[model samples]
Target: MNPETIRRRRWYILGVLTFSLLVVVLDNTILNVALKTIADPQEGLGATQSQLEWAINSYTLVFAGLLFTFGVIGDRLGRKRVLVAGMVMFGLASLLSAYSQSPAQLIGARALMGLGGAAIMPQTLSIITNVFEPQERGRAIGIWSGAVGLAIGIGPITGGLLLAHFWWGSVFLINVPVIVVGAVLIALLVPESRNPDPGRLDPVGVLLSIVGLVTLSYGIIQGGERGAWLEPGVLGPIAAGLAVLALFARHEARSDHPAFDVRLFRDPRLSAAVAAIALCFFAAAGMFFFAGFYLQSVRGLSAFQSGAMLLPFAVAQILFSTRSAAMVHRFGAKAVCATGLLLVAAALASYPVLGIGTGTPLWVLGAVFFVQGAGMANVMPPATESVMSALPREKAGAGSALNNTARQVAVAMGVAVLGSVLASIYRGELAERLAALPPGARTVAAESIEGAHAVAERLGAAGQGLIGPANAAFTEAMRTAAGAAAVIAFLGALVVLKWMPGRTAHREPERAERAERAERGTGREKARGRRAASRERTRV
Candidate 1:
């Protein structure tokens, strides 16, 4: 086959893979708006704070726990087969989630969906690696990465629109058509690909990793709400989780066919790109997660309203992301990424100051996110392109998995770390501010922020007087949390600037060469056609 033919086929494959990933990415943000509606049908199913936590965390736990194992399985079985099977599982789980009778059932179904997601996400990039020649892979990855931002942008709007018009179950139900369409297209279009030197799956490694991640996540989630950091309930799981993770690392080093690829970190560009993924996820996840609460609880926006409020971030991400490849080509990795990080930090830092009054203009909030979104658009695509393009072609499965694993770990940790920061400040501020009030009022104010209505019920008439102080205290806590988030964002930026290479090395350089050749080929084709037409006229 001609080079041009091969290039066209590769792009077609990329489309199928992108569709597969869209399911996983959409799931991540779709639940944000539906949480209240899902938990509170018929005036609410009496869902508790813990249940709400599990609703979100359950999906992440299973997804993160199984990612490495599934990656290896994809390498062993074939990415195409694994991707199909995963889509089926995801569809089934979504149906079950819609029918969940209680919070437990919903959480359980969501976990199942996560398992399916783990199967789906890694294969998209791996398939891109399989199909695209090295030179074109960066551009392909740029489009793939942009699709993620697109899914997120669409998720909130879709979720809100559905939830407002239909039921909470509508969110999960919406996935059905998408899955069916993707499955049909992939079945017809995508080809099978797998690892050349496939190895045995390590069950021990999977067990240890899952246990550790779950325990650590549990501690973080609970610590934020219940002050479990000071108690055995929080510390025990966290400590145990770390111990298990340590054991897994040691075991991987000793194993002949380890599930996790410890060797991928040996490459400087790959390592830097992975770290950037972690940081990108950490800041992005934290900002979005808390931004939900800030809109609803503090700003008094409803689910639909909050979803609408996130438009600036979503719009900017979609609009700017398509141009990321050109920007990377122009500015280089270090300059573009550093600029993105700084913008993100500035936006996060502005959150606290803006939280000061009830009259905070919606336009100002939107403007901050618009800038933040544009910065993020610059950072993610190049970083992802760099990482996937650096790996040897055969190692695509493992490399893609590792890239995603860093993102998942960062996402889980963000909820724990940044969520705890916000929760701790809120609890402390509330305690101090409410101290002089009546004992009952103080107790009412101390209930979980998730259950703030309970506190209002307890306060009775006295609640009116305390509202001003409580509002002031909550504003102060939000400001403090945003300040901390700013530091974290800045640190993430510094890491990107200091570590990620200004130029692509190894596979990346080769890919660039190929793109130049392809461009030359197109020019030659045009010139040949012009000469042939002129000669034909002379002959006539």
Candidate 2:
């Protein structure tokens, strides 16, 4: 009955949601370390590179494709109900993934896991939006957002530890207990919430959106690795995907009961926040994706060793994020977010210039990653709080879906576009160096860093000279990607500063008025408080 009790309950609910989120986000990063183990010749599935790639991409493709559809479904039915179903589905799928005997089976299981994730992800934020008051929304979202970075930062470590001690299936099996625990907490603590006027689900809109997103994601994933950006296979699907997306937009604009609202983008704060999230993901995803290669290939760190070294990234976020909401409360989202993005940009820019041959490069990297993690922590919560604040309470589910879908697409694009840029640069640099090698060896050397290593092994001591040029090429590509990522982060910062409004427009004034009335003990204040309390009681 008291605000204090309700506040504590809210925080407890937040913890459950954070744990649920850890399950989903961990899947995104945890599998990366286990992929080789899963694909090993003797102990695991003898999966080809394509199969291994699909193990990751299939989940992404299905997840990104279905997010908006599931968000709407959750809104129309009930968020709590959908979220519970998702947990069950995710747990069962993880079981299947753990027991998969073939690459096809694992990929299929991952796709199912993604489907469950689509249902779960949007509901977490939307539920928080419905329950928390405006004043506390930022802090709630800050904790939730911090879970993402924390999970990501530690996922590889967790996976590495598991793989080092257990079978490859242990990674997938790990999700089972978490899902069971999360589901129990969800059923007990998380309140049901939904859109009052969710309207009918637009089947055509779902179909179009799914096709577009899936096709686009496929092109990006395949194109980045195969260097098929302009090829008909990649280009054709990409064009079709864009056209379908445009058709979906046009159709939604004309519909009386659209599946999701596109007009939300008209709100500059929401638009800017979404953009900021996307750009930040683009940078972070690309950075970590390739940085693994650089650290292992160029610096010669073992997988577990590299993962241990990245622990500070999580530590920085976990330490700083709880306080980020306070920063937003005091200095406002615009300033805090701008400073954070600029910090991320500066960190990205510093990566290329740090000399790898020097003794201090690892320390420099640790410092840079910590700064980058802290920056991302600041950016996520404040920006998300601003975005969710802009939407009507009834549209929270669909709106949250839109926000997440934008982020998922940005990561896919980052892996594609930034990766393409890096690959192109590496190929160009290696081309000159590989010219004198045998044609077969040149072909292998030019493909990837691993391929170059294989070529060097085949050539024996004669190939020792190739390692220098290969490392040089990879380093140059790192510089190019990081430089571009810096530009992206800086642009995001500028957008937040220029477009995202401060508390003048977003913060509620009633709380301050209520405080003053309580302090002064006015008769009218008491009367109004009784009425307000009654209304809150009825709502609760």
Candidate 3:
């Protein structure tokens, strides 16, 4: 092919990657706007708090657990081939999720969707990592990471529109056509690629990782529901999960060919990059998790209005994402990433302090979202560039999987952990306050904010009194949850500043090669000088 055509194809390849990726990424937060509708007992599936958590967590848990397994599988198989198959799987799973009647069935379908997403996510990044050269990789990754914000932006809006017109199922169903189009584009435009020397499949590692993630998530969800960490339901699974993950580590530490190398964390850049992305997502997930209810339930905004309200965040994300690659080059990953983390920390910390009421505080809250969006935009693209640059092309799949796994795990925990904190506080606030109601009604009211609203609706004018206290209680819970997410983000900022490499991160190889050349030159000079000295001695 001519140079011009080849150059153009690469960007076309990027387009293909982004669309396929959107199919997976959009589903994650798309359901957030629809959660209220889904939990409506009259018009939709009546899912409880635990079940609602599962709706999101099931996808993330399975996605996180299987990422490395499938990454390796994709490396052994053809990336393009596996990608097509994953798209097919994702489409089918979305159909199941869209049609499922019960919460359990929806969860199962989401899990299947996650299984397909696991196959897709790593390959997208790994392919970009391999295809793009060092000079261009940052820009490529920036555009790639931008797609995430795009998905997040479009998800709520599209979900809101769909919910306004159609059933909750339409959100999942929409992915089918997108995935089909993406698959066709891939078949035509994308090149097949994989690791030539991919290692043997690690069944033990896969089993351990899957079990560890599932159990860990289960524990957190259980703890959130029960609000007791010491109970068997919480402690047992947590301990078991930790133990299994530890074993998985030990196994990797000893293995000749580890599925995902634990040693990558030895490089502070990669580790810190992973940490930064995970924590940012943690705050983002928690924010959106409550923002949905806070907007629709407490503030009385329609889902479409809520989606519109979030436009500032999406716009900020887009603006910053466009500039992040250049910013990374200008400021370097360490500084850019650290600053971004601090902004997210500040935004989150302000969450509780800022009121949801439509006044000056709400405007302040929008400003915070704008800043936080810019902050996240700075973090992911640079962090991805840093991590992918650190790895050799051959190991891109594993490295990408490791990076993505951290992100998926963080997302799941974001919902599970932060949601747990929110849940506990929301439930506690309602407990004694809700005690006045009948046993069944009180229990239902205390289960979730949505349930409280439902109970209030059912009780007629008498329940009108409950809205003030319930919303206030829920808002208080949100503040506490936001505070916790802030702390995590702040800590991540510290980690980035302290551990991540500076402007010279990209030039390390050139620096190393220069040092070797200098040493060789010095050796040659010494050898010449010694020979001259010996010749002079012989003449004497």
* Candidate ordering by lDDT (highest first): 3, 2, 1
Strongest candidate by lDDT: 3
- What C-alpha lDDT values do all the predictions have? 0.75, 0.80, 0.85
Question: Residues 145-226, candidate 1, lDDT per residue (tens digit)?
Answer: 8788777767877777877787777788888888999989888878787898877888887788778888887887778767
Report lDDT (Cα) of residue 154, candidate 3.
Answer: 69
RMSD over all Cα atoms, model 3: 6.3
In model 2, which runs have C-alpha deviations exceeding 4 angstroms?
Answer: 1-8, 35-54, 99-106, 221-223, 226-229, 355-360, 432-445, 458-465, 508-540
Runs of candidate 3 with Cα error greater than 4 angstroms are: 1-6, 355-362, 509-540
Ranking by TM-score: 3, 1, 2
Please tell me which predicted candidate would have the highest TM-score against the true structure.
3
Question: Which 10 successive residues of model 3 have the least lDDT summed?
Answer: 354-363
Which candidate, 1 or 3, has the higher lDDT?
A: 3
TM-score of each: 0.88, 0.88, 0.92
